[model samples]
Target: MKISELSRRTGVPVASIKYFLRQELLPAGRATAATLAEYGDEHVQRLRLIKALTALGGLSIAATRNVLAAIDQADSSEGALGAVSYALPVPVAAQSAAGDEEEAEADATAGAEVAELLAALDWQAPGTSPHVQGLTSALKELRRLDARYAPGELAAYARLAESVARLDLERAAGVDDPVALAERAVIVFAICAPVFELLRRLAQEDQVRRRAAGDGAEAASPR
Candidate 1:
């Protein structure tokens, strides 16, 4: 297929496709002429993946390149997953000055709490994982606000996380190609994260409405 055909089929603008080609986000098609090239199905797939990563996943060009490189180099499901995780941006708290002992203590406490939670859950991620560090940072803020979860509550959240992780791994295992698996992971996180949050909010609202109705009924019961 020609580049024009590739762009038309993928609904990606020709200029954007050219930009991707220049940036090496999408591999160059075969050179049939000085100005004409033939693209293949693989090129189409890669272009779509790039579009999803940048447009939906909100990754920058550099980040997308790193993610694609990781996917290309990954030899197994775990490796691909680790690459995706590393590529995904995680919010880290701003560090304090070197002499800020109080800030250092808070960070230490937060890291310890995160370690404890992960240990209790038996999750095997390395301490240096971006997700772990982000969670630790979040826990630090939660602690500062006196809103940290009790152990039991944290355990409940861990169980939910485990369930989601299991489903993700199960789906990823079906794709034999590491690159395709990484693409799937990118799409899943980009598209499903917001959907999951929406579902949770809807469920909470339903539960609250039910509880309010129950409370009203109980108060109306002539005791």
Candidate 2:
């Protein structure tokens, strides 16, 4: 697609898109004979992802860039978050149920999700135990506040929590005793996901109200 179309689709202006390109937040669309090139689905996906992260995710451009860079770096690495994986027990029954008929319904999908996330991110699995627990606490609070979120969303959140926990374990890999090691993924998740989620839902609510207001104006105005 052309820059104009990309702009229309993302609801971002062509000028802003160019800015991102200049900032390297986005990859160069294409090199053209005339001096500029065309864009494709990858650019489109990235633009949308950027919008969700910035507009909804509330991350600054620099932070978003860092996160994206991390994911890309992790994707290129071997696994288990590099040296951190050794801290984890090579991935275990940490998954609640794996091979049962009852379990095949993607019951423990969070592990896979977080694993994929780690592969994509260049983030470190911080070993902050209190931070991990705080995240878990926030999720519990979220479920209490809003019941509309699907189970899958909750599971995805859980996977992240687990990943953080594993990350804590990774940081402790140098310690020989699994019998006593501190963990902190839940705390990190608390600090990260919930407040962002609150923003996304509030944005959704405001968008709905704006549409309703516009409809009311339409109904009330001279036609």
Candidate 3:
């Protein structure tokens, strides 16, 4: 197949495909002549994957490159999983006023709470994990808002997260191909994240309605 055929089959524009080729996100097609190249099914698959990573997965080209590199170099499913996990963006903690004792105290408290939560759940994530850092920042903001959740409530949420993660991993299990596993991981992580958030928001609306009607669950009750 020619590049035009590859572009048509993938529904990616020729210019964008050329850009990807220049960026090395899509591997170069086999050179057949001075101004022409022959593409194969592999090129089609690669272009589709690139589109998914950039469009559906919401990854920047640089991040997409890293993810592709990770996929190319991955030796196992865990490696693929890690690649996708790291590619997803997390919230960054905003800087606080220097020498503010109250703000510093809140941060320390949030960090310790997160540490305890992780320990109690037996979830051994690195302190440097972006997810951990994001959670810590979230807890800090939550405390600042005076809407801090009880430890048991947080633990319950963590358990639910653990279960969700297990289910997410199970979706990709037994796939031996690195590219296939990476694609599944990207789809499950990137697409399902927004789905989960939207579902939670919808559930929150139902909870509000239920509480207004004096129905089930009774207004969250704050644990």
Best by lDDT: 3
Pick by TM-score: 2 or 3, better one? 3
What order do you get sorting by TM-score, best first?
Answer: 1, 3, 2
Clashes (backbone N, CA, C under 3 Å), per candidate, total 0, 17, 0
Name the candidate that leads on TM-score.
1
TM-score of 2: 0.40
Q: Rank the candidates by lDDT, best first.
A: 3, 1, 2
lDDT of 2: 0.52
lDDT of each residue in 1-223, candidate 3, tens digit only: 9988988999999999999999999888899999999999888878877887888888999999999998899898898788888887776666555468887887799999999999999997999898888999889887777788975999999888898899888999898877777778778988887898898999899888988898766667654
| Model 2 CA deviation exceeding 4 Å by range | 76-126, 133-223
Candidate 2 lDDT over 1-223, as tens digits, reads 7889999887989998998898787899777758668998778767765665456545677766764554344533333133222322121222333357644444333334444444455445443433333333343334334533463675565576567556544644553321111112222232334655687699678667867888655444554
lDDT for each of the candidates?
Answer: 0.82, 0.52, 0.86
Better of 1 and 2 by TM-score: 1
